[model samples]
Target: MKKVKHLFLLFALLFSSLLAPVGALTDNSTGASSATSTSQSSVAAIKKRGKIVIGTAADYPPYEFSVKENGVSKRVGIDIDLGKQLAKDLGVKAEFKVMNFDSLLVALETHKVDVVIAAMSPTPERAKSVDFSQVYYGDNQDIVINKADQAKYKTLKDFDGRVIGAQNGSEQYDLAKQQMKGAKLKRLDRVNNLIIALQSHKVDGVVMDSTRAKAFVANNDQLKAINPHFKTSGQQGTAVAVAKDSPGLVAATNQTIAKFKKNNTFDRVYIPRAGKYMSQRARQNTVWNYFVLGVGNTLLITIFAVFFGFLLGLLFALLRWSKNLLFHSIAVAYIEFIRGTPMMVQVMFVYFGIGELIQDIPAVVAGIIAISINSGAYVAEIIRSGVQAVNHGQTEAARSLGMSKQETMRYIIMPQALRNIWPALGNEFITLLKDSSIVSVIGVAELMYQTQLIQSATYKGALPLFIAMVIYFILTFTLTRLLNYGKRKLNRS
Candidate 1:
C-alpha cells in the first residue's frame, strides 16, 4: 500500500509539471492530421486577420527603448523594426506587448501576444516550448570593468577569484558561472544593481553585452569599460520564437528572417529605428534603470528610517514616562510640537540641516531618517498611552508579591500594555505604509514612482494610476489583515 501511494505521489508531481506546457499548446483539430499534430492549424486564418501582436523584453539595448522622438512609449528596439517588416511581409499590423522577458512565452501560450521577437536565445528548455526561427543575430557577450583595470583584464581568467557582477535570473549570469572559470560572480536583483556594485567597486567587473557596455560608459562619467572585451563571446546569434507545437508560424517566421537577411533589409530596418533612443546600455546596467527598483530603494529607505525613529521614540517615551518633572514636560512639548507641525517640513529641515556633515549619505537615506523621526513621535505617544492604560492594581500587586517597581513593570505592566496596544501598533503600521508612498516627492520611487512611470509613458492619466492604486490597496489591505490576525492569535494564547 505504501509503495502504491509513493508511486501515486511521484506520478502526480510528474503530471503537474507536464501540465503547464501541455495547456500552452494550441491545435486547430477539425482539419487533417487530427490524429497527432502540432502548431496552430489555422495559421492561414490568423494571417487573414491582418494583425500579429509580438511580445518583447524591451530592456535590451540598441534593441528596444522609449524615445522622445518616437512621440510615444510604444517599444522601440531592433526587434521593433524587424517586427514592422515582418508584419508588412505577412500583410498584417505589427503590434507589441512590452513585458518581462521570462514570461514572454507564457504570454504567447495565453494568446496575450502572437510572437516573441525579443533577444530570445533558443535554449533546450525553451526549444521544448517554442519553435525557433533561424538565427537572426549572432550572439555577442562582453565584460565591463573599471577603466583602471582595463589593461590587466583580457579573458575572463584575469578576474579569477575577483568579484564579478551579473543580473539575476539571466543567461548572462548563467554563462558567466559556467564559462568564466575561477571568477567569483555576484548576482544582483537587477542588471542596473550590478552596475551600481561595479561603480562602487563592490564588484571588480560586470559581464554584459558590448553595446550595453559602450552605452554605460558614454552615459556615466565615473565608470569606463575595459577595452578588448570578454574572450568567451560566441556567434552573435538569437532568433524569433512562436509556440513550439505551431510549426506553421515557425516556418513563416524563419521565412521572414531569411528574407530580411538576404536583402540586408533587416539590418537597415533595425538601425534607424534603434538610433531613436539615446542609448539605454548605461542605464540598463545601473540600479535606477527600472521604476520597480526605484520603488524598492524608496521602501528600503523608509524601512531604515522607521527603524531608527522607533528607537528614538522608545527613548523619548521612557523619558516622558519618568517621574522627573523636567523630562516629562520636555517629552510632552516635543510630542505636541511634532504632532502639530507638517511632516514635509520636518523632513526638509533634517535633510538640509545636517546634510553637509554627511557626505556620501544618500538622499534616500536622509529622507528615510526624516520619515522615521515622524513615525517615532506617534509611536511614542501610543506607547505612553498604553503604559498609562495598564491597571494601577497590577503594579501594586507585583510590588506586594516581592517585586521591585522595575521588575513589576517588566513582568506585569509592559506585557499588558503591549496586549492592549496591538491594535494601535497595527494601525501605526498601516499609516506608515501609506505615508511611505509620499516620500517619492523627495525622489523616492516606491509605488508612486512606478505609477508615475506608467503615467509618463501612456498619459492615460487615471488608468495606470488607478492600477497602481489598486496594487497599493491590495498590498496594504493584506498587510493590515495579516497583522490583525497575528494580534488576535497572540491574544488568544
Candidate 2:
C-alpha cells in the first residue's frame, strides 16, 4: 500500500510541474504571458536582426532622391530622414534598398524590405497587402507643364483633351484616371521619366504633389507649376508601409511618427537639407565622370553571366542529347519553361523570390544568376543545333578507329561544332550584354541605371539618354569587330 501511494505521488508531482507552466501562461498575474508575446513580436524580431531594411524609389526629389557627396552617391530626402528616425526609435540601423516604386509593395510582402518609406500613400488597395503607419506628410496636387503653355492650361478642364502623365501605381495615377475622364493618361514607372515625357512633348502635363511640382519648376526655368484643383475624398498623405499582420511593427512606426509630429522634424530640417543637396552645380554632373563605373559593372555582369551560361548550356545540351529518357525530359522541360517566361520576371524571382530563402544575397549576384539561367536555355538550343549540324560519319569514323564515345565527341565532333557555333555564340554574347540593362530594375548600377542617375542629377533627360545611346553603340560595335576578327582566325585555322 505504501509503494502504491509513493508511485501516485511521483506521477502527481510530474503532472503538476507540466501544468505549472500552462497555469503561469494562462494567468495574467505573473506577466509571463505578456513577456512571451513581446518576445515573439515583429519589433522583437527587428531588434534581434540589428537592422531594418528600408525600400525606396530614389527618383522623386524633395521626397527621396540620390545625391553625390565627394563622388559617393547617397540617398537623402524627407523620406530618408524619416526612415533613419524610425530605425533610431526601433534601436536598429537603417539600411536602404533602392528599387522601382512599383516593386516596393512586392518587396515588403516578400520580406525583401522591412518597411517602405518612399512617400507612399496609404490607399485602401495597398492596405489589403500591407499595413500602414499614420500619414507623415500631406500636400495638394499640381500639374507641371512647359512654361510656354502655362497660360493655356489653367484648369483641369483645359487638360481634358490633352495628354496627362503620372507615376504608375501612384495616388496621382488613380486621381488622373478618376478626374481626367477625357484625357489620355501616360503612366510611367518613374517620376523622372514622366518629367522627361513632359519635356519631350510626349506628355503635355504631369500630375504630382505640389511640393515636387514646385521643386521641378524651381530647378528648370522651362517648366512651371499650376494647380488643376482636382477634387479629393480625403487627405492623401504618405505613410510607412510594413508587412501585413505586423501590428507591433506598425505600432512602433506610428509611435515614431507621433514624435516627428511633435518635434516638426520634417518641416524644420529635412526639406532644407534636401534642397541643399539639390543645389549642387550642374557642371559637376558630366556624363564622362560616371562612364567607367557604369561600363565596368555592365561588362562584369555580361562576362560572368556568359561564362556560367556557356557551361550550363553545354551540360543541358549533353543531357538533351543523352539517350536516357529521364535526362532528355528534364532538359526539355527546363529549356521550355525558361524560354517561355520573361527575363524581367526571372530576374525579380531570383532577387525577391529566391532571396526570401537566402537572406543577404547581393542584388548583383542575383541578377547574374537569373541572367545565366535564362541565357543557358537559349544557348542549349544553339549548342544542340551545332552538334547536330556536324557530319555523323565523322563520329562513326572515330568510333571505328577504336575511339570511345567520349573521345569521339571531344576530338572528332567538338572542333567542327565550335567553328560552326562561333558566330551564333558571339551573337548571344552581344545580346546578353544589351539585355543586362534589365537588371537595373533591381538596382544593379549598370549603364542604364547610371544614366538615370545622371538624368536625375542634371535634370537634363534627353542629353543623358543620348549619351547612353552613344556609349551602348560604341560597346556593341567594338564587340562586333573583335568577333569578326576571331571568326577570320578560326576560318584560317
Candidate 3:
C-alpha cells in the first residue's frame, strides 16, 4: 500500500520542467470577439476530425465527478451535459478528456483538447491565452472552514495569519490572495485536495467557488461555508474556453448555452443530474465498483507495460552483448540513464515534455510508455545477468553440433538464461503493478487515484482507504502465490 512519495523532490523537478511550457479570456468577453467567418476554418477542422474533444477535471461534484451507476464508473456532471449539447449543436461526437484542472488551460493552448468545459471562470489573465464562450453558470466564491471553527471565522479579519487553501491556477486562488490579505495561502492542484487539507486541519480554511463549495460541504457535514462570502468584482460565471482566435467554436458554444438558458436547462437537466448523485451518496455502496474499475485499468496497463518491457529488455540485452561497440555503448547508456533517473521524471517528461514535438498524446498511452521504458531498463540488466550466468559449456556444445552463434544462443543459451531469471522476472512483474500507481499523478484513475477520490467524496477517510488496502493486498498476495506456484512448476520441469 505504500508508495515512495519523495514529494518535495518530485515537486521541485516538476516545477522546473513545467515552467512556461504551454500556453484563456474573461467570462463572456472574448478579448475582442472575432467574426464567425474568420474562425470557420477552426470550426471546419473540428468537423473534419469527427469528434469535439472537451477537457475537464472531474473531481468537482455537481459540476463534474465520477460515479458508478451500474457497476461501471462514469463521468457525469452539468458540464458534461453542456459539452455533449455543444457537440450536438456542432453536429459532431463529444469526447471527454480528463486531467487536473491546472492542465486544462494548457491543454487547450497546446491543441491537446478542442475546448475546456470544466466549470471554468474566464478571467482577464486567462483571456490572453484562450477564447471563452458566454457564461453558462454564474457563481461566487466562499471560504470553507471546519464546522467547529465556524464561529472563529465570522469575519475576514479573523482569518488573518491563518492558513487558507485554494486550488492553484484557479480564480478562487487569485481571489484568496486578493481578498484574504493577511491569511497565508496554500495552493493545491484540485478542489478535492483543498477540502482534504481543510478537513485534516492542514489549512484553517479553503476558498471555493459556490457550486463546488455547496457540493463539498453538503457531502462533508463537518465542513461549513462562511456566510456573506468573499466578494468578486463581477460575476465569476463558468464558461467554455477554446483555442485563441477560435470564434467559430465559440459561436457554436454560445448558441448552445443560449438555447439551454432559454429553456431553463440547468434547473431541468443539470440540477437533477447532480441531485441524483447527491442522493446516491446517502446510500453509497459503490466502493467495490470503483475498486474493480481501478484494478482492471491497473492490470491492463501493467500487463502491456510488462509485455513490451520484456521485448525491449531482450533487445537491449542482446545489443549490450554484441561485438559492435556502438550498439553496446547505446544499450549501456540507455539502461544507465533510465535506471538512474526517477520514474516520476520519465512519466512527466513523456506527458508534458514531449508536447514540444507532438500534441494530444493520451495520458494512458503516455503512462504505459513511461512505465514500460522504466521497466525495460531494469529488465535489461536482469536479462544480462541471467545470460552471463548460463554455463559456457552449453554454448560450446550447441556450436559443436554444427549450430551458428545465433542458433547456439537462441537454442542453447536463451532457454537456460530465462530459466535462471524466471523468478526475478516474476518479481519485476509484481513491482510494475505497484509502480503503476505513479501514473495517478497525471490522472490515470488507477486504484490509488480512485481511492483518493472516494476518500474526498465520502470524507470517511479511513474506511475507504482501509477497503482499498484490503483489495490491494488481496490482489498482490494472490499474484505472489500464483507466481511462486509457477516458479515451482518451472523448477520441476
Instruction: Report the number of backbone clashes for model 1.
Output: 19
Clash counts for all predictions: 19, 0, 6
TM-score of 3: 0.80
Work out the TM-score per prediction: 0.50, 0.89, 0.80
Off by over 4 Å in 1: 1-42, 48-50, 69-72, 109-111, 188-190, 214-236, 266-269, 279-493
- Judging by TM-score against the true structure, name the best candidate: 2
lDDT of each: 0.63, 0.83, 0.78
Model with the higher TM-score, candidate 1 or 3: 3
List the candidates ranked by TM-score, beginning with the highest.
2, 3, 1
lDDT (10s digit) by residue, model 3, range 336-398: 878999998788676765542344556766687788878988999999999899988888888
> Which scores higher on TM-score, 1 or 2?
2
The TM-score of predicted model 2 comes to 0.89
Model 3 residue 179 distance off true place after TM-score fit, in angstroms:
5.9
Candidate 2 worst ten-residue window by lDDT: 10-19
Better of 1 and 2 by lDDT: 2
Comparison by TM-score, 2 against 3, better one:
2
- Which of 1 and 3 is the better model by lDDT? 3
